[model samples]
Each structure stands twice: as C-alpha cells, then as structure tokens.
Target: MTDLHEALRRGRARARYSQDDVGAALGVSRAMVSYWEAGSRAPNDRQLSALARLYGITPADLAEGRDVEPEEIDLAGMLLRADEEIDPGAAPGIREFVDFLQRYAELADLLGIPIRGLAQSPFVHRAKFVQKDDVRRKAEEVRSLVGLGTGPIRDLDPVCELLGITVYRAPLGADLRHAPSGAFLNHPEVGFSILVNLDMTPGRRRFTAAHELAHALFHSNETNRVVSNGRGPRESFADAFAGEFLMPSEGVRRFVEEVGIPPRIVDATDAIHIQRYFGVSWPTALVRLRQMKVVTADTYRELKHSVRPVSLARSLGYSIHPEEYEQDAGLWTIHRFPRPFLRMLRTAVIAELMSPPTAASFAGVAVPDIVQILGRPHGNAEQEQPQVDTEFVEFEATGVI
Candidate 1:
C-alpha cells in the first residue's frame, strides 16, 4: 500500500508550505501535523479534506500518493554555463527550478489552460539557423498577432500572456556565477513557459523575456528546453529575435528621424532618447540603431565607450527609477505568472480545491495579502472598532509596546 504519511509530507513540500502553516490553518497544533505525517496518526475526514485543499490535490490522491504520471521530456541540457563550461555546483538549483516548472506545468494542465501559440510561433524552417530577415519577419508576425502594430512594446508581459506562454521572474540564486539570464520550457502538456532571472535590470528583464520567447517559439519544441546565456547559435538567434521584437526597424527609424539624431551618434543623449522611447536599455537601442544602419560602426564603438545610458537619461532630466535603471521590484504582476494561471489559481481557491496558505505560497505573498488579493473585506467594521479602542487605551495607559 502507498504510504499516506509519506505522501502528505511530499505534498506539503511540493506546495512550498511548512507543517506549522498547515496546522495553524487547520486549527491544530504542529505536533498533530507532525504525527499525521510521521504515520503515528491518521487525519480524520475533516482533516483529510483540509489537507487535500492545502496541497491542491484530491483527498484520495493524497492518501494514495497518486501523482500525475511523470511525462517524458528531456530534463538534460538545461542549465547555467559560463564560457561553454557548465557550472557543476549550479546543477541542483537548476534542477530544482526545473522541477518547480514541472509542477507549474501540471497545474496549468489541470487548470484547462490550453497548449497553444505553437502554430503561430514565429519561426521558419524550424530555425536550424537563425537568419536576420527570418527573425525580423517572425518577430513582426508575433507583434502583429499580439496587436502591437509596429510601435514600441511598452510592456512585453501582456503579449507573452496572450500567446499562452507563462512567464516567471525567479531568483536564479547567486551560487551560479555567469548563470543563464533566462530559461525556456516547452512542456508537452503545458504549452510554453519562460523563467527570467529577477536580478536583472528591468530593461534586461524585458529583453530576457523576449529572448526566452524566441527560444520558446523556435528552439523549445526540438529539445524541450533552452537556457539562454547570450552565447552560441541558439542564444544568438534568440538575441536577434528579442531585439527585433522589442525594436522594429521601421519604428526605430521613425523615432530616429523624429528625434533628429545624426547617422553617427555624437552624444549619449541620443542613445538615451531612443532607449526611453522603446523601454529598452541604452545598449540595446543603440545596437538596434546600428543594425538598422542609423549609426556607423565607428559611432557604435564610440557610444559604447561613453557614459552609461541610465546616467545619461537621468542627466537629461528623466526620473530614472531604479527598476528602469537597475532591477525591477520582483512583486509586480508583470514580473509574476501570466493571467490564465493566476485565474486558474483563483478559481481553485473559490471552488475550495485549494487553501489560502497554499495560494499564498504560490503567489509568493503572505496570507493577509492573499485575503486582499481575493478582494475580501479586511474585517467587520464593528469588530475592528473595539480592538482599535482597546489598543488606544492600552497605549495611553502604558506607552507604545
């Protein structure tokens, strides 16, 4: 017989929740939760139901350790590589990230989010080698599909969501020096997904998303995985795709003409102007300009050696928020899972198939934050007034605790 206690332990870990958390939600002591998992005791019917809800699994499945049959997808060839050598120490963390992706994919399948965006994937001839014209054409097609209309993509997250591609901003951790900027997975069951390291500059994050999108559309189906470290043929192609996707040649030229920057950029301010308009980094915008022949080779090199773009932008009177210059706040919806997945989680919670703590774990937020996310009233006004009054009286009698 399958060990229900072992199953319970595994389920809780998979959901990223602690024993104490589960116990508190169930109004039981931590010792009871431990006993149930240690096989010294079994949960009764009510406890079982709550446990299943907390784990986002069926009670029968929880008892039997019934997992979705593991699907065969190449787990190999996905990781952090520096100068062509794989970082051996990063293997475990990379694998853990992949495992988390697998769980998310299963959740996506369970939620009925269709496997899509492949037929519309912007690639020609399976992208055996990426060509400039091919990548530009493909990116334009993707832009058109997402209704971008040749303008700057102010936010690329929504377009990714629209393509049935789930994006996650994950902390890739500091263990892997020269780690991959992004990773892509084309789950046979869950469509396409991308994970961009949350530590990158916001502009870089945007670029990484587009780069991972390129891999998802072009490389993922073949090997079932792609890790982008900004090197080699596949990564090179992804970079090209990202550049074009974020900055179309025509739009860029139009902007350059509007801004009246000369063919050879003589100043950092010119690069700043273009980067801000496209929401890309100075280097990216400058490179795009170089690609479009707006700037000469000598000019590109000179600009690269000059003042940093963010500093120049700030000097030029731009507000220059940290996210725009350095790293983005990781908590924003744009930096998290796509709408369909979030919607499914909400539906699961509403149907009582998942508990609040589990949802909070998935959301990377606190329980109280989850309450707010669900749009529930914080508390009854009458119930809160007495507590506030008591707190005020106690503070007056003594002092601030």
Candidate 2:
C-alpha cells in the first residue's frame, strides 16, 4: 500500500520479472508482493530493504517513488573501469574476468546481498570446508546459516557470490568439453574460486558452480591428489555440497505444502513442475530432495531416471526460429566485440603481453582479425610491426614472449 511498494512493483514490471520472480528475488512470497502492491499491507523493514536492493536503489529512492533511470554504463564499461584500477600484471582474460566480478558485486547489490568494498574484498573469510564431523547435520546447519528459505533460486551466480564463493571463467581456450567443469583449490594465495566454462548450458553451469564451491572448502588445491575433476570421492563430497546448497530437506517439505504437490503427482509430469519451480534441473532437484530425505530413496531414483533430458532452451526463449539465422551472413551476423576484451587487448599490446611479433605468432588468430575487431587502433601498417612502443609507454604494462 505504501509508495515504496508501488515503486518496487513498477521497477520489477519494467524489468519484466513475473510476480514469482519479484518474490524469488526479494526473498518474499508471491502472495506477499501482490498483497503489498494491492494496498493490503506494507512490507516490513527487512522486506523494504530487500526490495530496494533488488531494484538497485536506496530505500529512500523507492520510498520517494523516483523513476529508476537506466545506467549509461553497461557492465562491460564498468569492467573497463575496473581494468584501469587493478594491477596490469593480471592476464588479459583474468583482468576482464575480474572486471566481471566487480560487476557481479554490483548485481549482488540488486539481488539483495549486503556486499561491501571492491572485487569481493579478498578479506572476507566466509567460505568454509564442509565438515563431515557429521555430514548431513553440517549441511543442515549451513542451510540455516545462509537462510536458503523456501524460494527457488534458478540463477546460481548470485547464490555463490552471496556465500562468498568466487566463480572464475577460464579464457585459455582449453579443451573445456573434455576437461571437467568443476575444480576446488584451498590455497591462501588464490583463496576460493569455482572455475567453469562460461559457454556451457545453464543447468550444467549451475551444478558445476556448486560442485566447485565444495572443493574450495573441502578438497586440496591440487586437482588430482585425491580426486580428479572426474568422478571420485571428491566428486561425492562436491555432490553432497550441491545437494545441501540446492535443497534442504525440511525447507523442501515446507515448499511442497505451500504448493500442494501430491505424493502420486511427485513422480509423474508434476515431478518436473516441482523441479522447475526450484529453478533446478529435474534430476538434480529430485535427487537433492531425496538425499535430504524429503522423499523416499525409491521415489527419488524413479523420478531421476524416468525422464529424458529436456531441452530448456525452447522453454527459456533461447531457441532460434526459422527467421533467426535467415541472414546471408548466417548466425551471429552482427559481430559486436566485448568492450572489456577490446580495451584490455589494447592495453596488453601496449604492455607487451605478447612479443613485438606476437601478432604473427598468435596461433590461429590473424593480425587483420585483431586490427579489424580492434578498430585498427595501433600505428601505421607500413612498418612490419607497426610501432607499438607508444602503446607500451602509455599503459606501462610488461610481458615476455
């Protein structure tokens, strides 16, 4: 009923989030959001703060009902600003990635995390190894600590960051498909990051991030010492971590009661409905549910293997229709370069991230390709190397061949 609630409803409407979406994001029930906006009752102080965070504004901004203006700088630009601030010794890809972390922090502000300071504050010692001093009980305790209430959190990035887990994307162009998607390292220097291939499917991305977060807290930094990225005891531990993080037994029971999912419906098509409501893949959701003893083991296995892999792309509107690739140039006809990569590449050139002739040595990457994508920003092409000294002088970056 308050102006603050009205402004929040408007902001989420512009962002095109469903009623359920506003609820999931603000950590409230859909019924509550509707009630508040309909003038039935106002959100409590905590929910009001959550709404302000979800809308990326101050409580005052929402209370005053100010128009939420679009930010001029995209996340990519904000990343470039981060690049300008951090040490240039970081690999170009790493630099861009760190830029993304800074932006992720900004997004956390929107997703209702009380994030403070820059780049996740290398100082926050929140991540802990899963203490199997009593495995199930430990997981239950974590569930209570983070307050993973009854809401379904489909996106995993915000969840991990909220838990103070670092998620890194490798740009080494390594054979990612063959390589394992999750790894954990408990080193003090690097701290914790669950490295993942950014280009993977959403479900796998979510699962892998959770798996790696387990390693950050449980396993050694060395990937192969006890458990390789492949299946092993380590995988089991990580699996436990994912299970605990994704679905808490008692919490899930509360959710089922709220939605009224019947026992008979639990294994049929209704299985996927419940899974989807949690924003997790059917199998993962069902298994985690069973693991936490929310359902019988027999029911869990039955639901887990009964169905086939459903392509979520179509449901999510990511599927291309016939008109999608209709252009003569084919799919991805328009090539918009990543702004952070471009500037960082330029800075790398100036700092000698590569040798003077590294362009020619750039494996499969072509010189003209760099020039083309990079707007041909360097000096005259008349000279063989095209004077890069000025660029190096400006950025003051250095690298060896």
Candidate 3:
C-alpha cells in the first residue's frame, strides 16, 4: 500500500503535472489529488484509468505498485526522465506525440493490425562508441535488411515503416539552444516509433529520420528513447550511419564513375549531382565524397565554399520544391502523422470503431473536417442503396423478356 502511494506520487512528479493540473484533467479537486498522493485517499477505478492515461501508464501499474520499466512506459515518461537533456518548451510536442502514438495504437488494434516490433540487428548489442568501419558495416547491414542495395533511399519514412517502425512528423517549435532535430522511442505498447521535426527542410527531415532509424536499430536496447541534437559520440555514430546508409561508398563511386568525372577533378557540380541523386543535403554529399576519396582534400575545400545548393540545383535544372524529394511538401496535415497512420484512422472511422471527434483529435483536425473526410460509416453507404418495387417490375420484364 505504501509502495502504491509512492508510485502514484512518483508518477505524477515524473510527469511534471501539478496537483491542480491532475485534478483538472481528471475532473477532481486539488485536495482530492493531494489526498490520493498522500495515501489518505484513493482514486476510484474511473479516476485511476484517467490518471494512468494522463501519466502514460497502465492502471495496473499504479494499482499493483509495479516498477515501470522505461520500455514499458510511453514517450511522456521517457521525456520526463530525460528532462535535463531536453528543453521545457519541447514538452507540448512530446505530449502531442505521445497522444498520437496512443491513438495510433488504438486504431491499429481496432483494425486488427498490431504494431510490429523493431527488427533485430546485430548493432543493437554493439558498443555505443563504435568505429567508423563498424558504423559503415551496420549501415550496410540495415540497407540489406530493408532490401536496398547501396542505392539512394528516395523515401526513408516508408522504409522505416516497412521495417515495423512508425514514423511521425511534428513541429517541435524553435528552441535553437536545446532543440532536438528528431527523436526515437521503443516502447512495449507502441512498438518502435520515430518523430522527426517538421520544422526542418525536406532533405534535413529525411536525414533526421535516417538518424533516428539508426538509434532505433542500434541504441534502442541501451536507451529506450533517444533525442538527436547532432552532438556527442552517439549522435556522431548515428550521423555516420545516416551518411553511409543513404549514400554507400560503392554507390557514390558508381555515381561518380557514371558522371564520367575523375576523382581529382570532382567539383561542386558533381557534388550537386551526388546530392540530388542521393536525395541528401549538399554538405552530406560533400562529406561523403571527401571520406570516399572521390574528391581531393583541396577540391573538397573548394566545393565547401562553392555556391548554395538550392541555387546550384536550380541552375542545374533540378527542382528545389519540397515535393521533389519526398511527399511531405506540406506540414499542415493533422499533427503531421504519417500517411499510413492517417489511412488507419480513416479505416477506423469507417469501421465505426472510432468516433469522428476522437479521430479528429487524433488527426489534429477539426471534427467537421474529419466528419467531412470520413463521410458516413461503412454500412451507411449500403443502407443508402436505391430500392425498386419488385411487384411492379422485374428484371426479366424490364429486360423485355
């Protein structure tokens, strides 16, 4: 009983919710919440369920006083545990993402499509500070796992989804100092998921997705959640993984050879070609080329100072529109959940397993918008079918028999 009270108090504290906040969310009073936390009172079953949902835990976890494992909890708990590493302003986005995952899982279950677990990889158990060669090898292994043979991954989101990793995009707002470009989580309930900042450009977003995917494949076992800010050794390894996974050495070499350019003379034009072909950022292309020795150090330095990629791509007849690289051109889709998840929401609505307003909240859209999109439920269309008087006319009589 003491352990249960302690667990409840700790859960609330870790969630960073005030007594008043919890009471408001649960439709109770601050005194009631305080009493519950103080072990002087206990919440009823309904309140306990609401509290568990708010704190991103199971009611049983609270009732049984079970020590919630990091992987067993949701993203909210994970974010709160890493509060020191992330900005306070990022909380809203994290909360929205947690809600999105919960809703996504619910809809998936309604549709009988359970969220799959993260595919196993040897790198999952490897050391965190792996060598560059080891990172490249892991990248190759992942590429093969995805059945991508040393080629540019035109779309990384679908690839992650193909490997049983749910990918979502949301605006984390701007917090230059402590902003994270992307996050990855492996939870027992939500399976594996990656959240890339919609604030980034399409190319950068793709890179971030690949980076988080690396963490999903490698560092997930060690840490249930990872927020990438492009710093530290772990981040460095993930970046390397993204570079190699997106543009393998052999693939780049083949591209350069196909371009009919010598290694020493490879310039910004060639780099732009690589960038466009590989669907990666220009700087990434330059770095990969430099690492592969396809361009001399002096040439790499010259290209680094060369023209901006967008202007160069335009001059080179390449379209710079967001749609040119991936389909995430507009960032206004309900919470920017992935297309696959949106489809699932639509299916849930049609199947009458979910309400329009609930689907709207999950989709980040208005109720009317969701209702308009979903229209009537699945059987309603059948019910609306036109009828004819069989006594007045028959099919054979109408057919002139």
Best by lDDT: 3
- TM-score of model 1 (CA atoms): 0.66
The candidate that wins on TM-score is: 3
lDDT of candidate 3 over 88-201, digit per residue (tens): 666777777778888777777779986675634345545758887888889888888879998888888678777888888777755546878878876545677888877666
**Which has the better lDDT: candidate 2, or candidate 3?**
3
What would the per-residue lDDT of candidate 1 be over residues 148-197, giving only the tens digit for each residue? 98788887777887887877766554433566677876544455778776
The C-alpha local distance difference test score for the whole of candidate 3 amounts to 0.74
Cα deviation at 112, candidate 1, in Å, is 5.7
Please state the error at residue 257 of candidate 2 in Å: 1.9
TM-score, cand. 3: 0.70
Off by over 4 Å in 1: 1-84, 89-93, 105-122, 173-177, 315-317, 325-334, 362-364, 375-401
Query: Where does model 3 exceed 4 Å of error?
Result: 1-74, 119-123, 175-177, 296-298, 322-330, 354-358, 367-401
lDDT for each candidate structure: 0.70, 0.50, 0.74
lDDT of 2: 0.50
